[model samples]
Structures are given as structure tokens and as C-alpha cells.
Target: MGIDLEKGGRIKKRNRTAPKSENPYLLLLVKLYRFLARRTNSSFNKTVLKRLYMSRNNQPPLGLGRLVKLSRKNADKIIVVVGKVLNDERLYHVPKMTVCCLKISDSARARIQKAGGEVLTFDQLALRSPKGSNCMLLRGPKHAREVYKHFAGVAVEGHVKPYVRNKERKLERARGRRPSRGFKRKPKKV
Candidate 1:
């Protein structure tokens, strides 16, 4: 009799090895990184290639202020971001450092240049460091979207925001919120 094979085995799904971007320039970068990843045996090149395959939404935008804060200790190393770099108006002072990204806002480009810092494209960065040497890879906060506010279960603690149709006097502002509505549970003691 043949051994049973259908119950315990399953095929593994493979992720995309190449980028989905239609731009020729991006495709060229992917091709270069693919070669580097295969030939150089550097984990950095592999990581960069994987990020290059991500969609625009998956690659969130990094803010200038946050980048400055995170890379404060390592000023000499180049900061590489696979997505856009946006300018934060709240940041008063811009630091002097080399930053490389796919796209940067006009204001951000001006600020970095004015602060004696150089902003480089991915192609330029590739020429400078093929194996990602002397570079720091950084990404934006992926869970910072507003949609995450309503992800928790209903009436759960931890300040999970509730989804209300509209903000009004008699909408979702009664019952558990106030003792006068009916009965209010005692606050949990720490």
C-alpha cells in the first residue's frame, strides 16, 4: 500500500524576487542589486534588493526630524531609506549628514543642502557603496496609520479609540462613560 501524503504536506509560497515598479530606472537598480546580492554574498545587498521589491504603501515615508533623532549617534555613516523623505516643519534645526532615498520633497532637499548635508539618489549611493558599507538602513513607522486606531476589540481598555459615526451630544457619549447614565464600573486599582 502507498503511504498517505495529502494530510501532512503543504507547499510553501515564495515571495517576489524582483521589484514590481514599472519605472526603467527602478528596474535598473533592481537588476544591479540582484547581481550584487548573488555575486558579493553580502546580507546588506540582499536586504536592499528585498526592500526594492516592496510596494509604495509598504515603503512608508520617513520624516527628517525622526531621521535626525535616530541617526544622531552615527553621523559619519550614510542613512539609506527605500521610500520618500519628507520635511518636518516642526524641526527647527537640520543636521549635517549624508542621506540617500528614492525620493525627497523639495523643501527637504533644500533644507539638507542648506545645512551642509548631501542628499543622494539610490544610483549615486550604489556607485559609492555597492555592498552597503558605512551605511545605516532605516524605515518609517509602519503602524502609524489612523486606521490602526479602531483595530482593538470593543470596550477594551488601553485607550483604543472607538469608531463613531459622528461626534454629537447623544451619539457614543453615555452609559460606560458616566455614572449618571445607569451604572459605572469601579476603576481598576493598580
Candidate 2:
């Protein structure tokens, strides 16, 4: 007699297409992009639609200074960002470039307008460039959040910060930290 073996069923794949946002305006934008993605052959619309479905953490805020620096060469093209744009006081001079984003800070808007740049909404951008032509899409640094500093399970090499209640000398200063308390880990050789 031949031995019989049981086979396992195939696991279902997780759906990564849906948006987690409940905001009406965001939903409207998603709807618009969905139609655009379907009707047009532009990969830009599809990319924008995918970004719209991302969480707030993934949609990191862009700084005006960085935006200016990046879009300096592409002055004629409109800058499209699926996240908020914040003003950077460090940037002494804001250049003239049209910007289109979900949200823009008052200071950043003022700065852009002062530099002869026009701020456009998503709807305006849709009407202007359905295929996303004459546009430069920009994104902020995703791993730049403070919470990322405390992430474990990686070879951070003492760079990962621990969650502490206080910064006082009496607090969190025990064994594994001080050699007097017990054995301390020696620094890695370069």
C-alpha cells in the first residue's frame, strides 16, 4: 500500500488597494482618481490613486525649503504632492513654481504666492493636466518620524532609543547601562 499525504490549502493574499481614510474630501479625491485611472492610460493617475490609499504615516509632510530645492530645475512644471506642505523658515528665498497638494500651511502658501507662484487644488490640477503632464510629483521622507528612532529588531548598533519615563540620572540608570551596577556591554570595535 502507498502512503497518502495531506495537502494544505492556499492562503489568501491581503488586499492592499483600499484606503483607510474616512474623510469625505479625501474620498472624493479617491473617486476622482479612480475614474481618471480607469479612463486614462496615464501611470501618474494610478500612482496618485495608490498614494491616496496610504496611511497618514506614509503621507509625510513636505517642507517648503526642500520643495524649492527640488523643483528649482522644473520651474515651469506644477508640483503635485499627496501630502501637506509646511513652511520652512530656513529657506530665505522661495522660488516661483506652481504647487498642487492636498494641504498647504498658511505661511507656505503666502511664501509661494509672494514669489509669483500659484497654489492649485487637486480638482484644478485634474482639469489642467488629466495625464499628469507638465507636473512633478514629490514625496517627503517617510522614515523621518520621531517614533522610528525607537524601532527595534534591527542592527541599529545602540542608535535605537529606549522609551524612558524621565531623563533624570536616578531614572533608567541601572544594570546593562552602568558597569558599577553589573556587567556592561563593551563597545563594538570599528
Please give, for residues 1-190, the per-residue lDDT of candidate 2 as tens digits. Answer: 5433322234355434668878999899999999999999999999999899989889999999899899888989999999999999999998888999999999999999999999999989999999999999999988788888888643256467878997665666777668887867677663
Q: What TM-score would each prediction reach against the true structure?
A: 0.81, 0.84
Can you give the lDDT of residue 23 in candidate 1? 92
Residue clash pairs of candidate 1: none
The list of candidate 2 runs beyond 4 A from truth reads 1-16, 153-158, 167-171
**Model 2 lDDT, full chain set:** 0.88
In model 2, the clashing pairs are none
Please state every model's RMSD to the true fold in angstroms: 4.5, 5.4
lDDT tens readout by residue for model 1, 151-182 = 76432364567778985646666676567877
Least accurate 10 contiguous residues by lDDT in model 1: 2-11
> lDDT of each model, Cα atoms only?
0.86, 0.88
